[model samples]
Target: MNLFADIRALVLDAITTLVTEGVLPDGLNTDAVTTEPPRDPAHGDMATNAAMVLAKPAGKKPRDIAEALAVKLADDPRVASAEVAGPGFLNLRLEPSVWQALPKAILGGGTAYGRSDMGKGEKVNIEYVSANPTGPMHVGHARGAIVGDAMASLLAYAGYDVTREYYINDGGAQVDVLARSVYLRYQEAHDLSVDWPEGSYPGDYLIPVGEALKDKVGDVWLEAPEKVWLPEVREFATAAMMALIRDDLAALGVHMDVFFSEKSLYGTGRIEAAIDALKEMGLIYWGVLPKPKGKAEEDWEEREQWLFKSTDFGDDEDRPVMKADGSWAYFAPDIAYHYDKVQRGFDLLINIFGADHGGYVKRLKAVVKALSQDRVPLDIKLIQLVKLFKNGAPFKMSKRAGTFITLRDLVDEVGADVARFHMLTRKSDATLDFDFDKVVEQSKENPVFYVQYAHARICSVLRKAGAEGIDVSDATLAAQDLSGMTHPAELHLAAKLAEWPRLVEIAARTHEPHRVATYLGELAADLHGLWNRGNDEPALRFLQDDPVATQSKIALARATAVVISAGLGILGVTPVEEMR
Candidate 1:
């Protein structure tokens, strides 16, 4: 089903033949050989650089190797023509029958037409949306959730054993602030006056948590000291916020396989174990770091503390894991968490963080390399901020989240499908503008609607064919003769379908899910292009005077729909059967 790969193998076979015939040298490396779509469509259907790359190594002229390779390639039944272009590049044209039979192959494969086994079942761990459980999930966390969840799905489709994970930042000063904030609301439940203080969460989302706490321990800790109430309140408030966070993720269709607690790493010797591993590798040390630039030496407190040699792995300077006060730095627990992941036997580790964490990337990668002794690879993706707009003005959301717009707010404003699709329309590293007006527009300018419309149009075609009593079943259409589908427009759409499997491997290999969004947009364009042409050319329409001949065209439409469903599934989007 991978047409490009099949053609590349054919080129290699011809190269081998030339080696045996003494036309080319033996032991020539064909590993660099590749067959890809030609730069210009007028050149040919496909092009190869086998002769150009092998010419110098084989001690042969480029044109000589190309001429010999071309003659050998012409013998294949699949290749209609092989022409030698400038500088010994070989451009190929496949038989029209190859494109004509694509619909049958696509229908046979269904949504799995582009699924790949590229990863060989390697275990991968993707950690994302590790937002603090202080309030409801916000728009930034939503971006991380969609990107990470979609990445896990894409990797799974490419035959990787993927685990979705969330790391909770509960063991921190912020949790203490959240605990105190809930206490204020608890006092309000008791009808007591409380003063508003700085560094306390003012979100009304904590009101319910406070009321629930009062119900559980009615007036028992009403005037208790901080020592007695802080711990219990911290634990209770964190649990409540996590519950709310889970509900928020559920509303957006994202669920994690694991929810790791930062508190778990404390008092468990896990941090020590991770640090010891680095020490054993000579990557951990106690030393005074050089005074930072732009700061006067008198103002800097140069202290010797336990440090990680992040510079060895390209960090600008060594990073301290434990400050002189014997308290763990923010990066300390992260090292232990990643070490735990390595111990779990994951072959690859991926993290999605906010763009502001750019400075932490190299150090994080260094620690994972040190802990795993370079056996494990870590990839970190940074998600930029999202700007929301409506009617060319900044859109304001409800006060449900208090200060920031919550994930639930975004989903409510434009259902989960539109939110998820529009979030990925741009790359993760780029700032995305989520305009309420533009995304919900039913016009072709809206990519999500455009793609969904393509699928819905296909469904309409199938239903109409069924209503007319035409046998449009896959079995019937797949068996119909398609040689009569010789129009340039029909063949163009089929050629696009042939690129699906190849596109899957590229996107999965690069760890980029935005490419799936990009590909779907292009595929929809081709399908719509073919559909639009049918308006002027009556012969190009799917439904013809002859139901039997119409079956072949319907098969092509079905194939396009099948691929669209598969792509959207990876993005965690439901394909629309009909647009309202």
Candidate 2:
């Protein structure tokens, strides 16, 4: 359950009662009221601006409103104290019993402890790692995959019906290039000497696809020209590359709910339908764009082109939907893809694109806005570059991926769990430096290990308690007198656990998965702090002389473990039952 929401409801009910009794004005909007964690823990457990926001509207001093609100709030059993602080901010101190009951709530909720219904089951489509199906996914794609997949998970946890999708860029000329590259590999598989040209994909990964092609067509396509083999070979090669990509994603624990084909947009009337949707709004026209700023005027083309009036919708300029040669431009298919998402009845659309696609963001957002008539919101998260290092030096590229390090290579070096956790340690917009040696190092510098170590430490404690014949099961722990957990160190951990539901709402609403990583790190720090305290004071240890005391201490430790597991589950990382 969301304790913060419950407190806010209590605060609102008190305000409404105040209005009904004519103690305050009848119509002060309560929408602006929000309950949040105090900026400083020293201030209070929770802070609200209800009095401050209503002061001017009610034609009363903020302190007057806060003083009146405090009395009503303190009457609630959950609120230990409500004091007016600063400029009418109400600081709330919840009772120790409320914090003591958190572990019981965690145990009762299991992995669903912090799950929220904020999104109210709205449909959300998240498109990510739509890299060209030319080869296996690389390091850049890995970041997008983790970010997208984690986002989907986060939204689902927040009660949004999320669809994890990958868009196959198989309709473009890039697939034709891939077909030619595979054809060269096919010749080499037949024992013919081959040289990979500049634009061809030259990787050992394609060697097997080449062998598969030989087994399929035998000598028929072997002797044929590009006219006879290009179509069949392109189809075969695209399928092979997609298989490799799927396998790469599988290795990292990513499974797409849908793999939308870009080729389907080409043959179907979808593109026309999407364009017509925009055109009906008077957003389509034939026009000449202003010369791009800072470029040579001599190279600027003033020729008229079929363009979408994207400028009206906040684009820098009206963008071309059709090239001069009458073929659909790259943006055309993209608009159709988004239109397809909107047509699927999704209430929200999210795209996880690489940093290189930053320029495409505004136009694509405009497209979704026009297609959905501003009824749907589109959020695009740009994943910046990930720089890899080995032994404090730059990591070399993987030959298997042709030009970059493959996701498989990273996962193989550091298992999927580590890869996913480390990838999200940084914000999606910030460039990340991933060091292979540092990530796997069993130290505080390695956040993945730090958090996992905390979980494993709790497991170690539970095992020790079990051997000592102390019943540490949930049923027993729930019955423990947690009020005995009064040590400052123990209380600190309970405070961290109390923030879980609030943190989930913030991270989910912001669509920022990095917040989860940061919260886990903080939680681990609190867990470690308590463990260190136990080393100094034996009474703080999980295994006390008294079974009841041990259960009380272990209950808190197990509650921390429960929250960590729940957070990691949302990140698609398996929690370590024990550190190896």
Candidate 3:
């Protein structure tokens, strides 16, 4: 049903025929050949670089190869005409029936119109939103969560076995600070005077945790010293924070398949095992690192430390695995976490990190490469910051989250659908501005609303036709005679529909879910454009004079809705059947 792919196969077949006839060299590599929509739509329906890619290898001039290939392509019934463009590019105008039959293909596929098998069921592990279990997830975490979730969905749609994962940062000084903060809250719950220290978390979100702690063990930790209460309170507080984080993610429709604890890596010999695996490969060593740039010699101290030879595998410099205090560095646990992922037998690994973690990418990749022995590939996508706006002014931060707006705050301000759709409007690496005023607007300026409206409008059309006793069932519409669909506007929409499968493969391969949003916007625009055109040209209307003609037109509208539904489903957005 992929017209572009079908045509590309035809182009390859023609090249094969040429080689068999000895018109071209026998061993010319045609892997570089590509067929795509021409940059200028006026030129042709599709364009290919088959001739240009083969000319030099075949020992022939570009024009000669193109002219010969054009004749071979023009002989096919699907190709209306094949003309050689400026050099060796072959522009093809497909038969009108090819585009006209696309609605039938869409109806045949239903919402699975653009589903692909490009991934071949390869296992892909996507780790994202590994926010510390010390607090609720903030806006930056929301961006990474949405991106990773959408990417997992996209890959699943393209036939990858995807597992969404989250790494909990619960094994550090931060958890201890969380415990102390909760201890203060526990004292406050007992009506005792407490001074909130500088390093302790002061947010009121921990009030419930403190109350729960008091309820769990009444007055036992009240008179205890730091050593006795720290461990028990740390474990309790970490679990409560994780529960809060889970709720925050649920509110935004994000759920993880696995929640890996950094603390689990400790006391389990997992970190040591990961490091030992690297050491066996001659990558781990004890060495003195050069003083960091931009620091004075007097301010810097030279010390021998355990290090990973990350520079051997593309990092800017070797990275330390242990600190001077004889405790593991932050990178040490991360290495073990990734090694666990590799040992889990995943074919690919993807990590969605905040833009602030840019410097950690190279070392992380190097560690995974050394651990997996280059068998598994790791891709890290860094999501940039999100600035919120409301009523033409910057939105204020949430008091509950203390330093930033919580994901719950965002989901409350705008529904989960709006939040998810707006988060994907920009690429992961680009800064995104979420404006409340613009996103919820019912006009074409809002992409989510516009795309949803197209689906809803199609539903309205179907309902109206059904009420009028037009028999608008898919079976009836799919069998209608669509030969009369000859208008340029009608064919243009079908052309757009033909690109859905191609778009799916491109977006999945690039690991870019923003491309799906962009394609949906374009598809919505085309549907809206044709709907408006019907106002002037009565013949372009979906409801026509002849019953079969009306069925054909409705088929096209239903097909557009079908593709829109599929695209929105991949984005994890519910397709609205009716606009409010």
Best by lDDT: 3
Off by over 4 Å in 3: none
**Model 2, span 1-580: residue lDDT tens:** 7788889999999999899989898978999999988999888889999999999889999999999999999999989999999779999998888888888778767777888888999999999999999998889999999999999999898999999999999999889999999999899888999777888888888899999999988867778879999999999999998998999999999999999999999878999999898889999998888888898988886888789988878988889998788889889999999999999999999999999999999999888888899989999999999999998899868877767899999999999999999999999999999999999999998999999999999999999999988888877886777887777777778878988888998999999999999999999999998898878899888888887778888999999999999899999999887887
Name the 10 consecutive residues with the lowest summed lDDT in model 1. 395-404
Error of 3 at 211 (Å): 1.3
User: Could you give candidate 1's per-residue lDDT for residues 260-314 as a string of tens digits?
Assistant: 9999999999999998888888888989999999999789998999999999987
Error of 1 at 379 (Å): 0.9
Please, what is the TM-score per model?
A: 0.97, 0.97, 0.98
In candidate 1, which residue ranges exceed 4 Å CA deviation?
Answer: 61-63
Task: Give per-model CA RMSD.
Answer: 1.5, 1.5, 1.2
As for TM-score, the candidate ahead, 2 or 3, is 3
Cα lDDT of model 3 overall?
Answer: 0.91
What overall lDDT, based on C-alpha atoms, would model 1 receive against the true structure? 0.91
Off by over 4 Å in 2: none
lDDT of 1 at 14: 91
